[model samples]
Target: MVRVLAFLFLVTAALALDPLPPERIQALAAYSNAHGGHALLIRQNGKTLHESYSNGHTQNEPHRIYSGTKAFWCLTAFAAEKDGLFKLDDHVADTITEWQSDQRRSKITIRQLLDFTSGLEPLFGLHQNDFKDRAAAALKAPLVGTTGKSFIYGPASLQVYHELLKRKLREKEQTPIRYLERKVLGPLDLGPQRYLPDPKGTPLLAAGFMQTALQWSELGSWLLKHEEIVSAFKPGNVNRAFGFGIWNNHAAESKSAREVDVEDTLDKKWHAQSWGNACLCRSAPADLIACLGSYGQRLYIVPSQKLVIVRLAKDSKPNDAQMLRLLFANTR
Candidate 1:
């Protein structure tokens, strides 16, 4: 009986997840504040471990997440697949019949578009709220690289995806945004957003979302429970660090892995960008994955630790590798 009790105690202790020490948490907050961060929220082991606000910001104010919006929209694709709408491997040209004539565009799959490997031009103009009829512009965007071989991160592929999803959901008399609200947002308890739609009513899929730290953390927390979204973490052929609107640190395990400043590199022209074996932070756990947006907005998840962190800011971006290194520093 004594031996059995000892074994049970060991198992329980091993399963328990302790909170990070106060000093480490304080350091992380200080790091965030130094980089213009307005809000910081952290959750671990199914509990709220830390929460703070700076820059005269309050918890009630929503901050623009910019590209972090992609992560939420990408969830709609997985949810659609679950609803028997369409598979990720399905060709986008199947729904956007206008592209059937283009040899390169016709062969592009939904996965390729979501993974930013569809070879579409990075049509950043669509990000502007006044750029009316974004879907039309995306359909006419030319292929600038080899399909499935280039990682062109921009609004064009996502706009194409929006058009495709819009057509597929038409039979049910549903819009893609509504489908997303019903399938993804509703479940996470995230209500309506600004969406930053063009005059023709197409939301900017690449950027434009305003969310508070607590609100964005909800997505990261929900991510841990849904096994179906595993596809979101799988890397594409060209960009090993990114897939389905989120970036992963899995490459940190490799000896040759290089920590790249994601925002700065993404700003480079596609031909100039080099994304091979990129790591967010070499010192952080390999399981660390993040939803990053312009101006230092970040929602980071370390599944192995049951951890979720949200940082919101504007006009200034922090170093991802440095912030993540601070988060996990000295924590084994």
Candidate 2:
């Protein structure tokens, strides 16, 4: 584990990579702007290289990041593990006692939930802002496949994980929102997000975060400076493309790697989606990780280059591979 250091010194010492040159930023921003993108911000080694906003978007204005919100919740899972709440592989049924009676559900682990491979039905309805008691609803979701052998990407797995976390925190006399506020958001200096709490006051864990481009980059910066981030990118058994609430370009190194517009693939029914050998962009470095949301919200983190780039937009026209190729093509 890398000794926790303020990013200033950490960037200077651990990552000797230089910031993106001026023309690179211009090219990246141009590509983004031409494709309905409203904001493009780039940071490297704890310093802002360039920040741009257009089309009525401002630096401070917040926009919905959608499932990009999952990465933040996943941070809570790691924090809980650090606090000895439970191991990532621990059976979730241990905390959600009612699950113990369900064979497949009882076998699900904490890591499975974060990775979206717990076999729980995707339950897309959980994304609705008014959906009530998401945790309870997720608990009732049945297995769509063998536990640990399926990648059912949706809000259900995360809601169940949240329920388990809530139970674990109760033993410590804490609440989930406070734990997230203190353990995750506070460190990033981000304020309370639009969690969209249900009638039961249980905040939706799968999505509903709204962050400005600059604000979203804060998480990317933290990830670049965190020494243990490599582990967080570990691909799951069911989905080689997703890991711990983040998507990776590890498959970019493969000859069979398919350049995928993730939002399109996710639009298909979970059973219809084929995630095998999916790579965001073959031209990008294999270490690249992304938090992608609907309608082209993006946070691209390249640990190898000590870089973090945020691209926020209104609609889903921006091309991921082309956008990344534009930036990396201008790299020194």
Candidate 3:
């Protein structure tokens, strides 16, 4: 009788010790702020953590999510796939039938475009051009490397992929943006669609996605729960997750713009790779916390603990993770 009681007590204690609650999420937010940006953490199935800082305001304001737009693009593309609009391996060069004559683009594939392995030379850095000029340049751009040799990591690849996506949808009389509204954003109750276009009036898929941090946070939460979406990022998975545009936080190849210079911070696992617009994302402190606590804002996902941490800012420097650690410490 005594042994059984002791065993039951041990199990009960273990369950009670699990570290998941609103308070812990809040601590992550405070810690994020300490890292350098104003922060917030939220829990919706799991915890979401978000941090933002600028101009004496953090919440109740929307900020641009620079590269985070990539996250949005990933979702939209998958939605297109789910609807059988196109296969993941469909060739972008062939899909955009109008570009068939372009020899430089012939070898490119959809997967290459999503993974930043497209060989297309850089076109965005040139002075922004009118739609006609941008289209012409995009069509004729030379290859810097063969398709799929390495990761060049730029917006033009996504932009081209966006064009391909638009073409596939347009054939069905569906606009890419509208499809997103009906599938990804609408169900989540997200709105105030804010996106920018190039001089040629093309939705800038590589960047240009603009929304409040709250909306982005909501989108992130959707991503956390959707296995179909998350499955796209896992290795050896049918999604061929690494090759897809989706953010794969687990792979060794998965790396972010911010990396630790110090050896001490290397093991924290606090450092993870995520892709989002670095300059355009803006959100309230609470919203940031909520988004991050749920989805981990790209790098960290403590599902068992139901925690996430996110950092957003303009001119974000490399030491940002340290600032996040400080925010957590101060919360205590």
Identify the leading candidate in terms of lDDT: 1
Residue 151: error of model 3 in Å?
Answer: 0.6
Tell me which residue pairs clash in candidate 1: none
Task: Residues 225-269, candidate 2: write the lDDT tens digits.
Answer: 686955666778878989888998889889999998887878788
Candidate 1 lDDT score at position 116: 92
lDDT of 3 by residue, 159-244 (tens): 77767777788767987778777887787787636556556566655554455456555655665556466556422222122434
Instruction: Mark the 10 consecutive residues where model 3 has the least summed lDDT.
Output: 279-288
Report the Cα lDDT for residue 242, model 3.
Answer: 40
* Prediction 1 global C-alpha lDDT: 0.87
The CA lDDT of each predicted structure is: 0.87, 0.85, 0.51
> Which stretches of model 3 miss by more than 4 angstroms?
1-17, 20-31, 34-36, 42-55, 98-104, 126-133, 234-247, 251-304, 320-332
TM-score pick, better of 1 and 3:
1
Candidate 2 segments whose C-alpha is farther than 4 A from its true place: 1-21, 330-332
* Poorest 10 consecutive residues by lDDT, candidate 2: 1-10
Error of 1 at 122 (Å): 0.7
